[model samples]
Target: MKKNTIVTTDTIAAISTAQGEGAIGIVRLSGNKAYQIFREIFSPSKPIKKYQSHRLYQGSVMNGANTSSLDQVMIAFMKAGKTYTGEEMVEIYTHGGSNVINSVLQRVLKAGARLADRGEFTRRAFLNGKMDLLQAEAVLDLIRADTDAARVQAIKQISGVLSEFISSIKKKLVQVKTNIEVLIDFPEEEASPKQLFDLKFILQAAHDEVMHVLKSYDQAKIIREGVHVVLIGRPNAGKSSLFNAIVGENRAIVTPHPGTTRDYIEEAINYKGVKLVFTDTAGIRSSEEPIEKLGMEMTRSRVEKSDIVIIVTDPSAASRYDEELSIAKEHKDNVIIAINKVDIASKDQIEQAKNAFEDYSVFPVSAKTREGVESLVQGISGPSLAPSIENAPVINRYRHKQALEHIELSLNAAINLIDQQAFPEIVAEEVDSALAGLKELTGEVTSQDILDKIFAEFCIGK
Candidate 1:
């Protein structure tokens, strides 16, 4: 990995838009010299001595030597303190052909502007206090979000919902710490019963809020990164057919012959704003053939890593019912039984199959006729598997979750000490530690290395 050299004072320029052919491409520059650089390269349709801030002007970009025009364009100049980076910024819009975009960027670079590093633009925005670290991370999340839920969550974070909530928690901790510190200074004064009760109440409330946010991490994980649902069962159990039915396309090869699927086939579908990646793996069964055995091994491996494992079976495979049920039991916590071929099976067979997996959630469906497939889809992301992620603020990043866990531990220690009527100094120390965790979470006391790693995940020019 290359190191990022971030010098906010220096004039930086880059192609902000993705590199490709499109209707328009943007070359962005930010710093003290942004306006000066723009003046050197841009020739407006009408001559003007001064450019108005936040106004787009039709123009033509000049070549590096300023002897010929490179491309017809539109330019916008934003004044410092009101721009995304809180610095004077300029954007040149040109035709999105590779040549035109590159030429425009090179011209800006030649005009005393250093090339912008990956995520340097947003990094500047963070350093300038236009947005907090959580919002900065959300910007990246928004760009990479593939589902509606992820996008909405990212938008909420970017709007400072999570930051404000954490800030409020920190404020409460600070108040408790201040009270303890005052008591420590005046050792002659005794804490009244009501005072002790109030302090404990605040601490307990803060702890509960932290735990609530922590519980949401699992659901946030599902929202930000979709769950992997793997299909597993013996050959001729209709695993491939079920896979095709759920994905609403013939993504996998379905045949009457056993072991038709030699490898896994995967397809993704967005259901209820959550992405579900379904993998139809080779049948799990005892086999002497080397290739079939390898495929079976892969199936078991997928089952272990999957977020949800669907065990496909049919009444015709009665002899292997126990064998398949045994495999499902290994991951019974996340396993869902899908009794396929129910369209032709007798009612007793379906009832018997359902009774066999009474311990797990079972859905009887015929892939050929598409019966009960929707119910099976709904079951994949049911409340037992994924928590409700409607509008509630959640900590999606591991960084935030780890900080919250540390804060919880500190709060727990403080609460215990307070209950025991320990020395004010010791209790204050624990509360202070929890406060530090909050600072770290909101980037009030973040390390340079951590900031680099966070922003490095962004693409160039973001």
Candidate 2:
């Protein structure tokens, strides 16, 4: 949040690789003089005259002005029409080092091209109609995705699954809307109620599809953020150990002590290609520590809003009712029971803990022995994984959601007007609004300003 990434039109150039030494670093140029700059700085392995588009040229890049050799490198010359900026583009691959990459990039900039806007290469792709607004946003989401579930969802989105779904809906709505307008256009020649039933049928069909998709939205958002899961139980119930096991990191301080973790600790888990965040909250017990008291209050609130809650308890603790139990009941649908220290407890004791939380999927896990941990992870991550369908569409961005809702409202208005047998113009207006919403989603109705805003969020060297 402290860093401000910039985008501009002065013809950008930047080191397009991660910071640090690597096998190779790429210095990229995108703008009018991209090819010209390459020709000036890079001499191709097979030197002729003209530069070709999309061809990798093995060559030596030298600073003609400084009379210095840069590296035995590769040059990718992209012509204007097909390049990232709708201008010529070039990438110089050189030995990975701060001095070499920086020197090459500075030479490119000095020759002509400017520093790239944070994600300018991609921004130009968006500008050139290579991808939609949703897809562009998905690229960022995919880069930011920290879990398997999230990555899968973001991949689905970036791959155009969600866009295709929305497009299909839009197509159907357009047809329905067109039919209604036609009926209004030819009022005297219109079909009777029996035939009007056809229009109604179409409306119902479109609505059904839209709502069916909307049903998955809550889960999609949850997956994108990696479901917030809170652990609650009485003191010394192996909650911290279980938390460490799931995250594969000793995030919470574990001890024989009852109140080792007085606050929440979070870590990421890759469950079934889905990402989940395990939050080990404070132990629920009678405690005089003001901080512990505050932690309990926080844990209670976290339980309220969490996507999943794992109640870790022993038979003795599970048998008794407390603050955590009340929260577990309120969020019973999202709660899972973890009978901890099963290595020490009998089957009867584990069963008793399971019975106490009959509403949840209970598992007996011994953190020390790493038993039943996989099943618990599976339970949490299963719901978030990508659906088996090829090209699963995930609507993970707020912008996509907003556009969909707008489209929905417009379609609803059109549908209602059709039902009331209103004038065609009113219904047509609604259809136009719906079409506008769809256009906005795909960048067909966007401006350069919006494009700048979107690309500016990317890392400077991306």
- In order, candidate lDDTs are 0.87, 0.75
Across 35-148, the per-residue lDDT of candidate 2 in tens digits comes to 677878887667667666797888787878557687778879887666555656788888898788888888888888877769877776666656677877778877877766
Error of 2 at 270 (Å): 2.6
Model 1 scores worst on lDDT over the 10 consecutive residues at 1-10
Superposition-based RMSD of candidate 1 using all C-alpha atoms, in angstroms = 3.9
Clashes of each: 0, 8
**Model 1's TM-score against the true structure:** 0.87
Tens digit per residue, CA lDDT, model 1, 194-248: 8888999999999999999899887787787788899988788999999999999
C-alpha RMSD values across all candidates: 3.9, 4.9
lDDT measured at residue 367 in model 2 versus the true structure, 0 to 100: 86
- Tell me the lDDT of candidate 1: 0.87
Error of 2 at 129 (Å): 1.1
